[model samples]
Target: MEWNERIAFVRKAAGLTQEQLGQLLGVTRQAVSKWESAQTVPDAVTIARLCEALHVSADFVLLGKEPEPPDNAGDAPPYALPDTCPCCGRPVSGTICPVCGYTLPTTPPRGPRYAIVASRVSFVNEEDRAAELVKYCGMPESYAKAAVHQMQEYASFFLLRRNLTDSAAQWIAAHLDGSCFSLRIVQDNGEESNDALLTKPKAMELPAPAAPKQGGLGFWGVVGAVIVALLILSFF
Candidate 1:
């Protein structure tokens, strides 16, 4: 590609306007515009700076095999987690892209309320789960509508991350305010469990991790022993 065209394409790929590029380069927007139009060439210094700013090699800036970026990042969420829908951060269920309002795919409902046994949850890969859930979500559920929407949003996120798609990721990113989502995924331990983070659950209960034994009155095993001793003393 011609140098000017390369400059313009890179600018756009980086999602910058000529004006922004100019500010970064400490040049006037008209000068940047002229360079893009092939009316004038920027100095060697500016060319090097542009290459650095664009995260491209000088060669890539001057000449690339493809001549332009494929705009591949357009589809993915701009960022991914502490940045998920504020209303439902990393929601186990959601209908709209909390960030973009892009209607995420959902599982339509069937005759029965749907859920996998926590042990059975891992049986489905993200794609299958997403597909099944989407189909189920499409079903009508008066009470579960909000929960279904949340699930659909989560399914989209799971599938997007499952695949190598950028648009899927970008939907999440755009809402994080130029930041990425921060989250930790835990594997299921073959028990049915509700998302601990959810404010409410449909039917599934949040699995409580086993508690440590404590020497306290409310400790059941300890209380049982105390009751047994009290019974012995009362008999005496």
Candidate 2:
């Protein structure tokens, strides 16, 4: 193709319109149009700008020459992981297969892992709270039930599970927060600080019983006197 045609090709390949190309090159659309129509040619400085903007070598644009690949280009192996997991045959994310836990041998070492801990819940019953844990945190029903029971009965906080990726942990924490679970993310080693604690709903406290009014017959006082009179009558 002629150099003029090459300009049009590269501009279209870069997904830029004539006006957009002109904006990048600090020229008018009419100038870009004229260059494409062979009515004018870009000078050396403008050609350099065009090459930079279009990401094409000057030889490719001027002499229709394709850039040569590096000598060791073919020596490099292709990507080690497939678009889908080989074991589960499902689409995968990051380095690990979330479905079947299939990990690529060539995958790089991951960053710090995380663990999610449960502290409290707005739900009234342990079953409902356990269901929320299972839904949001993806824990098994048995494990979730046990965790909820532990959090409710014996512990102020329960370690739901550990060894989670950063993204997975964040996602679980957000969803648990949305579901009214008081939770926190900590390192896989189970270490946590006050700053790492997410919002935890305060445990509901029962109101203290009111003191009886002095010199007045309260309902309980009347019931107590009636019980004494019945005891005396029974003795008679």
lDDT of each: 0.42, 0.60
Q: Cα deviation in Å at residue 119, candidate 1?
A: 49
lDDT of 1 by residue, 102-167 (tens): 333322222222222111212223344333323322222342333334444553222111211123
How large is the C-alpha RMSD of every model relative to the true structure? 25.9, 31.5
TM-score of 1: 0.30
Candidate 2 at 53: error in angstroms? 34
- Using lDDT as the measure, the top candidate is 2
In candidate 2 the C-alpha lDDT for residue 3 amounts to 76
The estimated TM-scores of all candidates read 0.30, 0.35
Candidate 2 lDDT tens digits, 77-105: 75555555433344654344444333433
TM-score of model 2 vs. true structure: 0.35
**Stretches of model 2 off by over 4 angstroms after superposition:** 1-109, 189-236
